[model samples]
Target: MTSIISAVPACPQAPQAPQAPEVPQALLAVEGAGLTVPVVGGGVVEYANLDYAASAPCLSDVAEHVARVLPYSASVHRGAGFASQVCTSLYEGARRDVARFVGARDGDLVVFTRNTTDAVNLLARALPATAGGVVLVDLEHHANLLPWRGGGRRGTGDVRCVATQPTLEATLDALAAELRAAPVALLAVTGASNVTGETPPLARLARMAHDAGARFFVDAAQLAPHRPVDMAALGIDYLAFSGHKLYAPFGAGVLVGPADWLDSAAPYLAGGGAVREVSTTGVDWATGPARHEAGTPNLAGATAIAAACRVLTALPPGAWERHETVLRDRLLRGLGALDDVVIHRIWPDGGEPVGVVTFSLRRHDPALVSAFLSAEHGIGVRAGRFCAHPLLARLGAPGGALRASVGVGTTVAHIDRLLDALATYLRVGPGWGYAHRDGQWQPTPDDRRPPAWVEQYA
Candidate 1:
């Protein structure tokens, strides 16, 4: 743990910031690996969770880390006793571990927040006034898009969004055109797409942004879990990500970037830890991460995030890519062979993306498909626009899509299970009928009962 704190790389200078799948006994084990859930026909099936893009199950290692540290948890930065001191040490150390995980520059600031939304909003508030504006793309999540959309509390005239093109090269050209048209403060992009699982060339984007006199930022919520991020290597100026997406449960996130603008900006919150002096007449605010994080922090969340970073970083080189590739390929092939299935993609001339695939069955509503899968087959997948309304509009899927993402634990058997379920559903349809209620689809006259623990608790 101490070693992780010291492993973050220091860069000369610069800025910027910031998937799915299934099956089998996963190549990698996660929490709830052997858990069973009640399904249709009064029987149980191992939950076929194919929704890593939304929120992943806790990693077994991360759970163990959480349990190990809970006893030492206490008031952070305020306590003087051994537990408090230890807590404080761990709390502060998380920033370093996270920084190391993302290969953040030496002098970069890692500000902890509730999640990616909070992280993005923090950067939105801290951007230097002199900096022109932020350039966004069509394929951004709401967490990235809404923060800078401008108007009301969000402010306006500081954002410009580009439309994606047919190919990645064309998309880059489109992005470049947008940057050239104006001297923007930053070129913001997602490191890996959540909807289509596309990974734009970060190095090229960084070069494009710098050439246009704009700093580059990446929302790595999707990319970080599948690939490594080196701000220096990628020429990124800022980054943001969520621990929930990284398989840590207590809801932690990070915004890593330069100190210049953040120091110049006002504190994100007005509270105890964010000040050096507080008199009635005037108050001197604190700087660094404390400037933005101004209250009792989530010690467990931060620690869990740090522990997850350690676990991911320790995996053998290319381990994640190898695991997800096999499962993703099997899924893509199976889905492709299915009739009347439209696989949505932003870039036609593409690359091997992260393990996420979104598609729509020709005559099936995505909600019904998801509900049917869950109720009848014990499979879990995301069914929605995925919060990138613009991108969904571009793809002509305003209604929504069904996304299946994989993790290291996902296996060939799991992929086959989902494929088989989808095939069976498309061919024969559900034997039982479903109804829409509470804004979702579910089996009518459902008889499945909750587990004993849930029933007792409820």
Candidate 2:
């Protein structure tokens, strides 16, 4: 494939172009790319992080952007110092950048939050009374499901959940029935499954919601990094995503939607910046984004997210999709070749997605297999319910499964490394001994250690 990452800079570089010599020139440069760790068998190997869905590594470009802005970093909004003014501009500009990245329409508000969970909660709290009840799909991540489902929360509309069907068409049909049966205000769903990487038909779902007189909301935390989230074109009324999942490892996320519900409803946070006037008896709340973004905002995190957006948005057309699709296909095909390896997916008709693959080994312990991958092969993957317990139960894997997710920084080499490691583990079994401890399997007498700096903090 043509190199979409590590592209030559538009501006000529200084005398000797600055680059991390050890980091591989892959789809994108990420933190800890070239770090080598000692394996259980007395050999060192480059650490392969296949856990991007959990929290992606920071992009090198975003890190540089953050370093350049650090000198000017200061408290944002209404601060009188020069650094504060600069930071304010950077923070607000970051909001605009995120809005554009998601194809926000006019009158849309971009409210920054701690992460996707905070963004979802803020939206749930800001839902207007007239918007009717919320209709959620059973496939949502806990971030999206927990907020609206909470009891006695102000502005959390009457919540109802619809279980997914065997197929995408049937699932949409069921959602439509639920919406038509009730005076539903919103149809909340995940743009893609974090566990299976199966993307629901978002455009069709959006249309179904509108036809039933309900608005559409997507948990785009998984979709934004791999695919474009054109909210306007997709007819999404509200969307939430996290920067950490987008290669910006910053504690920031955003809610992009119309300002009407947010403006009319109670402020998400009742603190200093959210209010216009503070009286002993009653307080006046501000409007627009400020109405919700209370407390000292994450200016640095917002700036980093904006830097990540800029980097991702500048990619050539179709480059991002092509890169992930090719690599994921390679992984799927390799895993398919393995006997008794059950790859779990929500829909057989699942759409193109980010590179997330969840699988189970029938004769092996999933946690043990994952621990072996890390300790013996220097590969990092997630093994658990993946915070989507409902989906896990529905998939018949209540015991949890192994998840290997790729990112913009992931490469064919990384994909092959994981496949090879799994094959080795399954064929020969984990050569090292592991014991279940602290609710997880650990290699017994593990000799691998973190870099010295990690010890310094301890």
lDDT of 1 by residue, 105-150 (tens): 9899999999988888888877776678789987899989888864
Off by over 4 Å in 2: 1-25, 155-157
Q: Write the per-residue lDDT of candidate 2 for residues 197-280, one digit (tens) a residue.
A: 888878898999999888899999999988888999989999999999998887999999998888987887779899899999
Deviation from native of the Cα of residue 241 in model 2, angstroms: 0.2
Q: State the C-alpha lDDT per candidate.
A: 0.83, 0.84
- Candidate 1 lDDT (Cα, 0 to 1): 0.83
lDDT accuracy of residue 34 in candidate 2: 89
TM-score of each: 0.93, 0.92
